[model samples]
Target: MSQKRNIFEEVGEQKASTPTPQGGMIDQGRGGARRGIRAWLMVLFAMVVVMVVVGGLTRLTDSGLSITEWRPVTGAIPPLSEADWQAEFDKYKQIDQWAIDNQWMELADFKEIYWWEWGHRQIGRVIGLVWALGFFGFLLARQIPTGWTGRLLFIGGLGGLQGAVGWWMVASGVTSGEGVTTVASYRLATHLGLAFLILGYIAWFIMLLSRPERDLMQARRQKEAKLWGLSTGLLHLAGVQILLGALVAGIDAGRSFTDWPLMMGQFFPPEAFSISPLWKNFFENPGLVQFIHRMVGYLLFAFAIVVFLRGRKSAHGATRAAFAAAFIALSAQVVLGIYTVVTAAPWNVAIVHQVFAILVFTLILRARFLSGYPIVTSIRGA
Candidate 1:
């Protein structure tokens, strides 16, 4: 027998229960508790992507040295008055870039370059703010995934270092004499390499969080070990190619040799090691830097072919498809590289090349992720 319900109660009326994680502990279910954190990571990802593009533009337009100082707090405000603008321009005049290269530039002309560098730095500030607010908010609320706090912290640490590295790169050009108009190629490469690394790290984190933690752990059991190694190798090789490309950009090497298959009608460029000290040639010798970039591109493509062939052997269709996509992207990027060289690395074409590089980079990472946690397919198809 059951007790009678109160007559005043309407049909379906009952006490509402509070929804919460089962057992009062943070659960790692697919739809549980971590979506907000994932969204925050995605916001950071988008901001960084914009920063990369803006940074590329900064270099392409020769605007990186517009600001003679690193004013993290005060620099956010652009030149407000004509006097302020003149003050900024006067400072730029002291640098070799203005002294030797841009001496003809008037105040109006200076402002054009000034905005590019300012925009780049402002994005950096926005990213740091977003990270700080999100990280602390999550930590205080106990919303961070178990074992993930340190990973999030690492991103912040890298961002902080990136600011310093950016300054270091700019300082190279600023402190040099009239002979130098840009930062050292090696330092530029270092700066770009770090940006790519940070971008890759954020991407990997997003991929890992796409599914529940338990799913990833289970997927590891079926990891394609060989494919993983192959993809990892491809990632490393691609990274080297990117740094080499940066070197080419740093020294305007792409313009030095407009011919693709051969440099100045020869397989090897002339005066490749003309710069004395020998080691300096790698960074200062435009012909030599461009030659290395071209050779590496060829090697990178060959190795990609090998990786693709091995990838086709994978039992998982999705894994095989990922490699196929990566291969296609690599092929397109190779063509773009050749075109960029032939066109003498015009700003528009060169920027497209850089954009494609980002695509290929991401696709390679995707293939690696698939190799590690492949999506199983049915006998019929994926």
Candidate 2:
């Protein structure tokens, strides 16, 4: 009984002698707020994809220059009255697209092309709105992670720059006389390239956020160096193929040849070097441009085969599976390219071809990521 009276006092004295724990607050590793931000970025990514597809369609239908002016704010609202519609049509008549290619287009016919262009631009505006709202909301709430603020802001800036580039691309055709009814091929390529760049950046950010920082750091030690490097090369080669596709579409090169595994009944088109001023053949010459595109596609497929074989030997099951999936996509894309050439690039088939290109591009990125941070799996086998 006498010892019990002093026991509680002795324990308290012992605890007070130990040192206090250091550090103010523990890092939770980008838990809740970062997850929310990732979801928001995903939404933005989807919108950008739609924007690219619509942009492609606009070009496909020769509807890109329907709107002659680039009124960023005022253009959001389409014509509201009969008089307004006429005024819009009046502006279109001033361009060579109307004077040459669409001279027979009445007001009703004009509306079809007009709406396509309008919808494409409208999507751009909405994307900007989404980025601004999400960025500021995260900023105010302190939701963005420490190193991510700059990355996000860079995306928003790119979005803004994309708008200006869109206008610049549009202006190229608007200023051209009746001789040129479409935007400059190089400008179109620039616009398309920037769109993909933004898409890729957002995709990378999403992947980075998928794992905790400490885990990624630890995984870096076991990264498959050769596979990672090969996948990176594949990524860049796919990018070049995409830009070439844009050039093909720009000059309607895809529609110039309807033969597969050969062009104009030859492995190479007979007139591949026909364009004068030499360099213009790469951009403006339909035969040469399509030939380059087809040759590059073959080379890309061959390199992808090499990369896939290496990827199959990776220790991680998921890494092997990702490369398998990428190979599948590459095979499908090659088949689609043949069909596109055989059919002369019909809108239905051509759009599918374009979409599959995007899919292949993304799968390469996925495979690249898996090579760097492989998913480990346990097996019960000897």
Q: Local distance difference test, per candidate?
A: 0.90, 0.89
- The parts of candidate 2 lying over 4 Å away from their true place are 1-32, 176-178, 379-382
In model 1, pairs of residues that clash are none
Model 1's TM-score against the true structure: 0.91
Best by TM-score: 2
**lDDT of prediction 1:** 0.90
TM-score of 2: 0.92
Q: Candidate 2 at residue 359, lDDT?
A: 84
Residues 1-382, candidate 1, lDDT per residue (tens digit)?
9769989999877657735445522343324346787788889988888898899899999999999899999999999999999999999998889888898999999999999999999999999999999999888977787878899999999999999999999988996465778988889999989888888998888888887776677778889999999999999999999999999999999999999698999999999889899999988899999999888999999999999999999998888999999999999999999999999999999988988888899899999999999876668774
For lDDT, the strongest prediction is: 1
